[model samples]
Structures are given as structure tokens and as C-alpha cells.
Target: LVGSATVLCTDKTGTLTENRMALAQVWLPSGEALTLKHGQPVSKDCRKLIETAALASDPHPSDPMEVALHNARGTFAGSESSSTLPIHTYGLRPDLPAMSNIWDDDQALTICAKGAPEAIISLCRLSDDAAQKVLKAVEDMATRGIRVLAVATSTAPDRQWADSQLDYHYTLAGLVGLADPIRASVPDAITECRRAGIRVVMITGDYATTARSIASQAGIEEGEVLTGSDLEALDD
Candidate 1:
């Protein structure tokens, strides 16, 4: 297959990137955003955002994003514990694309959710203006090659869990942007492929701007980016 192939299609995360995710930026609904530097103290709001995201994620996480959340929580919020386990969990679904966890906190149920920005925004039921502001923030982060996730929190009724995550009323906490640095060898490898007369194509679920930025870093030629919506509008 390698000898016969004239084109190579690759996923961006884990393939081109080191897969070691790092918390880089935070955007809040108050229109406050901050870019973080290593070994620097994060703002209180950013620390709260990371803590909430960590609560929403699995305690023993294997996914890169969840791992990053845990790491960030430790770095920003210190080694504090949740103390109580989650009473209920709403798993990520194709239709909603977000997940929520309900925890028993001092006889009250606290819900935390994190996932795709669109899903969380919908869950928060933000006004048109607020939603637009969030979308703009998402775009700005994506343009910088940051993978963004929306974070939210809610209060749940005792012993009455919803069948779906959508039933709860959530407040948008903030957005977290994770950075996955490209692998060191990718650019030279891509150049070698070009010299060998092969075309390199990046396939990712990331935003078009993010894909374009990573492609440029990896030495892939600038070309048309077809998103899911764009593909749906095309004829097969």
C-alpha cells in the first residue's frame, strides 16, 4: 500500500501532535480571556474553570483532553479532592456531543459538564448575543491552533436525575483551550514525502483554522478545507 500510494491521509491529534495536551488559555462568559504560561499563576477564574472541567471528567482519565484537565486542576487548584463520588453521569452522545456529572456535595447535587463548545452553549441556553460572543472566542482560540472545550455547571434536584443532560439548566462557566504541540519530526517527514512525490492530507475534527495552522506547521500545502457541514452540502 505504501509503495502504491500517491497520497497520505492522516489524523492531526496523536499523529502530528505529541498527544501531550497542555492547558493554554481560558475564556469566560464575562468576556475575560487569558493566555497561560508555564509555571505562572493562573487567575482565580481560570482555576475554577479547570477545577470544574476536572470534576466533569473521569477521575481516571485516558483521553488526552481529560488527562490535560486533571493535570491543569492539579497545577492550578492544587491537590484538593472532590471528597464525594458522582451520583450520576450523562455520557457524551452523538446528538448532544457533551457529558455531565452530578456529584453529591454536602447534601446538594452539583452538576458539571464539559464538551464541544456548541453543545455546552446550547445546554447553557445563552442569549443570541452571548452565544455569538462565545463563538467569536472559539474562533480566536482555534485560529491560534488551540483545541477548545466549553465548561458549564448546574444544580440538580436530589434523587431526581434527568434521562438526558439537556433536561438540566446549566450556566456557562467558561471555555478551556488545550494545546497539543506538533511532533518534532513532522515537518521534515512531510518535506521528505513531498520530495518523494506524495501528497499529504490532514484529516481532523478540529476547526478549519486549526487544521490550516497545523498543516502549515507540518509543511502541508495550503488547500481547500472541507468541514463536515461543507461535505454535507456536497454531492458524493
Candidate 2:
């Protein structure tokens, strides 16, 4: 452990936090924010947003013939979205929520939220603006060692009912992000890495501000990260 270094690599999509995106705010096309929860009857505003998201989305359901459903989300190697399936893609589910119109996995639920955080901070109904604040709050939560995700969903119709294909109104519930206190084993690992004189670097695509926020939470100070542009300048 003296002169050599071992590269301990990791993927960040979710292992750092929880794996499903949660619904934060429901912004109506007419510019109103609303909230909808499972088992609770849908609100007029929430239904509007969901209907629009669903109308604009293309959800690929789980069918027995599709062999790629078994693969993990975001990994397209042997899966459908490698340009081979012609119509398949997967994204990170930040706050995984359950709803009747939504498919469980491999399917993208389309429910868009809108608003200015400053305008909707106090409106419990919800707003895009408020959604951002909620996200900021999650970031704040992360600073305090909590993990978080943004969850939102759209519904066409209950899959269990007559026609799951029919598009209907949808709603925006609320935000769901997750986090946990720094685990005990991490300190030992950090100590080991330091003892070996190894430095672990974090690479992220989040905005510099967010990345810095996360870095500080993970005990990395300085609040600065090198972006591709920064790296280019360094090469010069």
C-alpha cells in the first residue's frame, strides 16, 4: 500500500442515495400548483398535469416478449435502448412513487411540473417554483446527511381497469428525496485510503453548485469542482 494505488470506483446514479424520483409539485398548464397522493382522490389541477404528461409521453410496458426488461434502468448495454430496440430508453427514478396510471418499471411516466420557487414557497397546493425550493431543501437535507429524490408521475387509466391505454387527467403529488447519516464503514474506508496516501476524486454532471453541496456533505471542502471547460483551460 506504499507506492501503488488501487482505483476504487463507484457509480452515482442512486447508490449514493435512494433509487426513485419522488413527485414534488404539480404545476397546472394554467399555472397553478397542486398535490396528489396515493389513495387520495385526484385533484382537478393534478389531473390536468398528468393528462398532459401522459399525452406527450411514450411508455413502454413490461411485456413477456421484451427480453431487456430484466436489465437495470440506465444501463443499455445488452438492453433495448442501445439503438437496437428502436424504441426504448431509461432514466434515473429519483423518488419512486406508486400510482394507478403509472407502470412500475422500464416505463417513463410523463408528468411535468412548473413554477417559480419564490412565488410558490408557501402554497401547499404546489408550483414549479416551489418544486425547485423543495429540491433545494433536499440539497439542504443532503448537507445535513440526508439523501433525497424528486418523484412525479402521470396516469392514463388504471392498468387494472378496462383500457390502460386511455389517457386521462393526472396530478403532481409532492417531493420525495432520501438520505442517511454518514455510515460507519465509510470512515474506516476513508482512513484506509488516506493511510495509503490515496485521494478519492468525485466526478459528477450536476451543476457545479449542487456538486459542491454534495461534496461538502461528503467531507470534501473547497467547494470547487473541475468541469470539462475547466479541464480544457488546464490543458492550455
Which candidate leads the pack in lDDT?
1
User: Compared to the true structure, candidate 1 yields what TM-score?
Assistant: 0.94
Candidate 2 ranges beyond 4 A from true positions? 1-128, 157-170, 203-223, 226-236
Q: Tell me how many residue pairs clash in candidate 1.
A: 0
Scored against the true structure, residue 156 in model 1 reaches a CA lDDT of: 76
Listed in order, each prediction's TM-score against the native is: 0.94, 0.38
Candidate 1 on 1-236: residue-level lDDT in tens?
Answer: 78888999999999999999989899988888988876788778778888999999987789999988888888876755456678889999989989998887677788999999999999999999999999999999998889999999998776578888889999999999999999999999999999999999999998788788889988899999999989899987
**Residue-wise C-alpha lDDT for candidate 2, range 163-186, written one tens digit per residue:** 321133323433322222333445
| Model 1 residue 196 lDDT score | 91
The superposed Cα distance between candidate 2 and the true structure at residue 131, in angstroms, equals 4.5
> Residue 11 lDDT in model 2?
35
